[model samples]
Target: MKTINTNIAYKEEGTGEVLLLIHGFCGSSGYWGKVIPMLSEKYRVIAIDLPGHGESKALDSVKDIEQYALVLKDFLEELGIEKVTMFGHSLGGYITLGFAEKYNQYLRGFSLIHSTGFPDSEEAKKGRIASADKIEKAGIDIFIDGLVPKLFAPENVESHKQSMEEVKKIGYEVQPQGAKNALLAMKNRKDRTEILEKTELPVLLIAGESDQLIPADKTFTASGENIKQVVIEGAGHMSMYEAPEELGNAILTYLNHG
Candidate 1:
């Protein structure tokens, strides 16, 4: 585990070909905590906290998804990671798509977990602007409370109260500016379905059967011939946490087959 000067905080463990794990928006390297130990046994895992999240310094200018991708690219270059197998969740998945677009030769494969390749709908874009404005004005406290319930399944909220609370705490601690920047970037992200269509790189599309944010149907629509889709049953948007073992096995299986 190390913090690089690029304002990117990462944890590196085990050994083998590099596997970079990128967390979603409002998420940090912490999200990969459960899966890292298991993954480390097979591959050297580098879990990163995107700028403005976790231990990373907040950035003053990260207005779009490409900027996020550039930050990731810089982090890898700084570490001398020339080629990698990437596993990106949600917003991280979007960043992976951007990375593949610009640096496909540097990648062996990439996975999109509980994420989408479609651009934001007009309404979704409007909501993002409104959310960003609200975060800027009302602050993050209210936003954190309002967001937690929507992030997980109702069963988790009821049965896994402590885990849910920890997630909320992380969201609460997030820098408002970072959250705002992420929303702005997500709002402006281009439709990346064509990247999947054009690339020959192997892709693993991991979806939660009950994901509210990105439906299973949408995953199929976005997937191309080169993709292997894995749907985790009894999981929601937070599939990594909800079914870490299953997700880890799926990832390992993909890597093995590759």
Candidate 2:
């Protein structure tokens, strides 16, 4: 797919209802490599590299989640995608919440994959600043080495060596500026719990059984008639790699019946 000069880079496939896949921090559209083909079988799939990740260029400064959401809106408009279902992983989920808050008109439904609606704790905020500073002082490679391994459930790390390596590869490819910006954006994001209670659209919250970053308790915090939650067994923060089949089924079910 072509890159929009002022926005994100993306890859599109299939042809039916639109399903937008937004990658998490440190990931590009390539993060969805495994599930995109499966989802595209029944619906059009557009996976985008959020600014600063993948092949997408970095923004000049750290922008808030709202700004990231607007970037998504602009992307959809540029593609003439009037309505869509969104699946966001990690940081992608935060941007999705921002989209749900500001551009609900263009949404059919949305899912949070191993993600949360809560804003960062004060400690987490300080951690983000430190992470950014570390990247600036050192380099992205060392930072990625430390971060990528933590993303997997410890149990799965040994068994899923190839998968873990892929995650690390993507992490290593991340533009330092882009990763830093995402960290700042996530740090500043507001608690979007109200969007969960307010939007009439279907909401799917998928948590990994072993996600250390955002545990199931944090991911499963919201509840409503429109909300559905699924916990993928034996998975971690990177469910798309650890358990793509389960992730795909949850997404397909939401699209078909949500």
Candidate 3:
């Protein structure tokens, strides 16, 4: 069901150890729809719409992913949830890292799906600035149409056309200001690779075998024994849509054994 806590909107289902799902840029709790039912069969799944996206209100003065992490702490406290195995996709992963850095007590473990803990390379920062400008000049729809298709592996683009559209539909709902703000937050995010590599807490790193946006090399940076990396075949950055079952199973295996 949909609920609001501390102004954050979320979808909660099933019951057991909480498994929190956080979606990427231009996404909401809806991005987890395909995998939630499958994973929720064995665990309580809570998917949140980050501020400024989905149904959540935007933080007008939001400066970085760290602020979003603070919002999440308040959100979880409001719900009386003390711990969760957080799984973050794309931009969501950055916020997760911030949480891990500042609030380890709140996480049992965490996963970064199709995301990296490294700071934005100069090239990426430039791209982010350009994207923000595009959102301001042309609005969300135009930018989303051009961006979503590139998230999929080239081979899956034609085959998963419907799923692509669904993603776009979700992207279209992102408030323009929210999208632009998210870009700025991401561009300013710091490198959290140390948290991923050195944390004693169990960590799961999932990479889409053919993700054009973030390759496996970037996602599998942690060499510590505490980290587990899985690459979903026939998938890209949008594995939640391209390979939900595989993605869900990877998470289950990690949770079961970690």
Question: Scored by CA lDDT, what does every candidate get?
Answer: 0.85, 0.89, 0.92
Tens digits of per-residue lDDT, candidate 1, 40-72, equal 997999999888888887898776888888898
Clashing pairs in 1: none
Q: Looking at model 1, which ten-residue stretch has the lowest summed lDDT?
A: 217-226
The candidate that achieves the highest TM-score relative to the unseen native structure:
3
Query: Residue 181: error of model 2 in Å?
Result: 0.7
Model 1: what TM-score? Answer: 0.96
Best by lDDT: 3
Better of 2 and 3 by TM-score: 3
* TM-score-best of 1 and 3: 3
Query: How many steric clashes between backbone atoms does each model show?
Result: 0, 0, 0
Write down the worst ten-residue block by lDDT for model 3.
Answer: 1-10
List runs of model 3 lying over 4 Å from the truth: none
- Judged by lDDT against the true structure, how good is candidate 3? 0.92
State the lDDT of candidate 3 residue by residue for 1-258, as single tens digits.
Answer: 465656788999899999989999999999999999988888999999988788987778666898888988888888899999999999999999999999999999999999999999999999999999999899899999999999999999999999999999989989888888899899999999999878999999999999999999999988777889899999999999999999989999999999
The full ranking of all candidates by TM-score, starting with the best, is: 3, 2, 1
Give the C-alpha miss distance for residue 21 in model 3, angstroms: 0.4
How far is 24's C-alpha from truth in model 1 (Å)? 0.9
Q: Tens-digit lDDT track for model 2 on 177-224?
A: 888889989998899877887779999999999899999888887788
TM-score against truth, every candidate: 0.96, 0.97, 0.98
